[model samples]
Target: MINTWPKNGRALYTRETVITAIRKTITAVGCVAALTAGAVACGTEQQLSPGKQLSNAFDAMGKQHSLSVEMGLDATPDQLIAMSKGSDEPMPPAMAKAMSKLKVTFSAQSKKALADTEQGDVTGSSMKISGGEGDLVEGRFIGDTVYYRVDLKAFAKMTGSPAPTKEDLDAKLPKGLGFADKILDGEWVKVDTKAMKKAAEKQSKANGGSGVTGGKDGKDGKDGKTPSGKPTLSEQSQKKILEELKGVVNHEVTIKDGGKHDGADHVVATAPFRTVLKSVFDKLRPFADEMSPGGAAKMPKEEDFKEIPDAKVSVDFALKKGKLSAASMDLAPLAEKAKIKGEVPLRMTFDDSADNVTAPANATAIDPEEMIAGAMSLASGARGATGHGGVHGADTSLYTG
Candidate 1:
């Protein structure tokens, strides 16, 4: 077996390294929490209107201490192609193939009783670009730690790394990174959340302050300071934008099937693509001008916006037991823009019966820095082995000459 520690007695992992490895995961969960919080703040009033009822559902959802979320997306090949047309960068052939076969689904159940305490489990799978089915990865979060159970063979294949052995991990990894011993033994890898939080705080301080607030000039009123130093939307501004949207988009409300859906309410909203786009652009013109090269002179014309074919966006909301149970958005206009034959739909549903999340048992804690160092070591070893020499001997002629 490889030695876990080196002679230097220095730790291999650092707060920064661990934070970077899991930042994306944290952001994803944070977004869900933010959305729930927004709904609660926006819909706390007692009202019976259809819109108010929808808002009330969101409020209830926000109040739940624990809930489950399921999200899914399915795109046909044509729809995928249409989606790719929006990207400025060219998609590699392999990636394009993977996108064509893409079918993504994920679900999580989370609970938070205190600001410092939270827990959840996430699981998901996608179709592989190759002919085989993709492996499902599962993770559990408790307190400030996350434990992941991954299929080693599939992980190696996806990452283009050799299947890691216990010896390799022990020898190559630093003591902090050696948390992989459990993973090598076919168990989960534990990540330290406290370290991640510390790193995040350090990063914020280094970047000049908490990223959530603006300078003394009130550049960021609330919601958080944006990089552009522009003012965030105020409630008054938001209401005005909603009014504009109302003028452009049609709204409808209907009682959904009472028997099948447990007496839930449904709200359907639709808007003409061109009209909505124009209204949005008009609202954003000031900001765009500030950021654009030629300012107001280069502002896009209404005529230019009119080039898009007239199509519609449909958003559906379902409320049950005074809580938002499900929501969906369909943007069919973009398909027409790309001259494709299908629509891409996104959907999410909430379940409030989730049990409290718990940390995985017997998980080995690993330092983030150690994992990174181990990967680098493996890569370096591979490169050295492939140098311009046969296994039998090195050619001295090139170096001497």
Candidate 2:
């Protein structure tokens, strides 16, 4: 107590009290120092140029081996009606009625590894399209396969069909009517991965080795050999893309405080839709001419391009802990300007703690071959019905002039 008080003090504090006061003072100083350091760091980050920040963000994203992505469309009833009205063709009454009652938002999320870009298992995935009363459809993907469950009662109401059951879905169709026979029983429809792969391969072969895994001109090698794998852009090509993006976009940096994106610094890049689209169209003009009968004459002029309303496309990247943590793209401005009153938002988040995907048990397998055959049969029947000579062709005898 004697050491705690100065010589001038009338009353000396106890030794324990002095110790407590010293500890409290030290804690307060430490907290203030921490706050000052944090503020300094934040200011330093804010001072970074947007381009440099983008490069750092891209580098971080490239290093990530696993990520989760969420994408969705949000639309109100009025928006839906507006979109339908904007369409070239008149909306059917039934469809219009459905749209009027529809207050739905569709969303999907997937967690997957990016170690192998060509093929990676989706460890976990889910999609839900909810409206009026509840979810109209719900689906999940595990490993290489995806399964979806439809609300039969809701679907029946929309399609003006009687209440549907598993038996109704599995029922045998008329001999020539092969369209709906592939529909599976029960609530879930499981898509087979192996079958899908085989189908894709078959299609690739049929298309002269030019499919999803083919090269620029659609062929694999110079001599139209089977594709070894999908062609990846060269480093130079990637650099060129980055350069083009930087040229077109205007970038700005800002700090986000609190909420889901708390304490992270963000870099936002925005570009006018018309300008970007015009550049793309110009690059593709030569190819467009080759594909069209009138060549460049058939191409739309700059005035025509102007018909597309001016809008901005914004992309926001969030950086945290000196690394890129998440990014999002917003197309709302563009959509709104085009008189399309709906929004399609895409967001992706990176995580280093993700585990490998495991195949699900009790999943029902489906046959891709059977589905393809059924689709072809239906297509043939449609051609015939339309007077193109298939199944129910228009009677030429009745057209006697």
| Tens-digit lDDT string for candidate 1 (152-225) | 55434433224556654554434565456666555777778677545544555576675323445635435443
TM-score to true structure, per model: 0.50, 0.52
lDDT of 2 by residue, 214-324 (tens): 555554556544334433556665555444433332231122222235778776544455665566456446554234323456666888776554565555667787676
- Provide the overall lDDT of each model, using Cα atoms, as 2-decimal numbers: 0.46, 0.45
Root-mean-square deviation per candidate: 12.1, 22.7
How far does residue 29 in candidate 1 sit from its true spot (Å)? Answer: 15
Best-fitting candidate, measured by TM-score? 2
Clashing residue pairs, candidate 2? 384-390
Model 1, stretches more than 4 Å misplaced?
Answer: 1-48, 85-135, 155-186, 196-264, 271-312, 372-401
Error of 2 at 332 (Å): 6.3
